[model samples]
Target: MWRRVTSLSHLLSSPKSSPQLTPTSYGPKIWETLSTEVSKKSGGGIFSKERSPFITFVLGGPGSGKGTQCSRIVETYGFTHLSAGDLLRKEITMNSENGAMILDTIAKGKIVPSEVTIKLIRKAIESAENDKFLIDGFPRTEENRIAYERIIGAEPNIVLFFDCPEEVMVKRVLSRNEGRVDDNIDTVKERLKAFRSLNLPVINHYSNKGVLYKIDGTGTEDEIFERVRAVFDAWK
Candidate 1:
């Protein structure tokens, strides 16, 4: 059922190009059209007011420990963990229609199109039985944030920004042998550059919206989770 609704048939025939790394590469018209089609097919948006889940956007640079903390949150609080990166990686491994595109974008340390990422996220949310969700490594750009709001027709309940030093983040990424294509020094540097140039604005936007929690990510795993735990506990 989900496969039929979330199929990438529309994008499969798209011209092959190194996806532009800029935030405004795709216009609002595209999102509006896709959103409308999705809404019509689903009978409504994926989320409705009464059933709207508790959503926390977990954000951080590479190796900022957001993933580890998300695991802790799921264990302690029972929120369903949804890592956008993991979802995209699964697409690549499964050789889905969007696999090659997503692989190229990630290798270049660029973001996948909001349309593709958002559909994957929506499918995950719809399939899950849990109401509360921890969405990690998403909305890496203002465009991503806007597209999500426009398509999902809802805003995250809170946004978590794991604040960590560049030096610390780099050191951690270099040491952690995750065997990911983007884990190399060059790719990690590129990811940091993209993060600073793109992700920070999304953080500031959420901060201005008063839903952003800036957590100090420079500590032992337990220490950082404690800070993250406090934020979730308050929301609880």
Candidate 2:
């Protein structure tokens, strides 16, 4: 199972403090949360410019290995990967009533209310220590995109879509051993259905606007990552 790069509790304890980016005990299969001793150029670590900072949104259906690819990018390039789902899941683990409700909602494969999700996105972006980012498993709706535009004040410079077949996704999810409540077949099916019925349009909108790039996701993990690497390496 892939655990979070680190516990946010550790980060929150010393807020505004840069702890340290230790060598990751977990392998390269996960995003390694990192902190630096020195404050970077910008207080938030993500630079503020007249236009948007360098950012990319990773979009894909379940089992398309979006998380795996994000991990790879964080390792090879110096981009921070912010997963909206992981942050919400951590809130659940905190065991507050809020956490419990979020955990239950996540397991059900429904979207968390937009305000709740947007609040989280704002905080995560503000805490970043890196300018480049690969945000995964997010903007699952047109509403999600609009909220980001309204709150983050910038849209993504690039959007990467991992295009995989439904059959392949089903088999991959069934075999995925993370033990995530949402990884179950029933939830997987519902999520997929919801993604196609609801989320594909957001993807298409980006594609039409010339900001979308598609990578073939039918191959092995290494093969899929190679495609993502090409897209990101060419990032300006």
Candidate 3:
């Protein structure tokens, strides 16, 4: 998924787990205040001196286990897990005006606009009480990346790319049974095409910045996470 980037159509599974729901050390009151503060502030507003959270961007093909590994990471490292796909799905569920548009976009295996995805992420960050975050399956395009930096006034501290083969990714997605809008064969193929044309440049950008950690994602979940844990260990 990460290396050759020839195809990534299979990584588009429904995100079944969310680390964002995990409990935080901060109380509800703290979260309430934090949410208020974040809501009032626009992206790139003032407070340039304010430090953002420790963010780790997890990138992979649709079936590369980004969601599964994020759950493990949250348990082990106490980072809030925020899946961009989940956030977009939530917007759909809430019947937001943008919901239909988002659904159509995903159904076609095209990326939702950066503004929409970034807004959801910014809200999640503002509401979160944790200082560390594992933002999964996001910044899918260079526009997405630049929008995040411009609006959030922060860049990810680390980027983890799951390097699974296209064949492996395709098999996993085919068997995922996630009931996702984009899980069909045709959509998956388009998503793979989008991954190469849209997402790879973002990955290359992060790699050049020296914060990208490429992990072999061909093994069982536990085995892959062992590698993931080692990366975190080294970071610590």
Best by lDDT: 1
Please provide, for model 3 over 134-219, each residue's C-alpha lDDT reduced to its tens digit, 9 standing for 90 to 100. Answer: 89999999999999878886667678888777788888888999888888888878888888788888888887775676777878
What's the number of clashes in each of the models?
A: 0, 0, 7
CA lDDT scores, all candidates in order:
0.77, 0.69, 0.75
Candidate 2 accuracy as lDDT: 0.69
TM-score of each: 0.81, 0.76, 0.79
* Runs off by more than 4 Å, candidate 3: 1-51
Weakest 10 consecutive residues of candidate 1 by summed lDDT = 1-10
Candidate order, TM-score descending = 1, 3, 2
Tens digit per residue, CA lDDT, model 2, 96-134: 657877887878888887777778766787676556677
User: Which candidate would rank higher by TM-score, 2 or 3?
Assistant: 3
In terms of lDDT, model 3 sits at 0.75
TM-score, cand. 1: 0.81
Give the candidate number with the greatest TM-score: 1
Q: After superposition, how far is residue 165 of candidate 2 from its true place, in Å?
A: 0.9
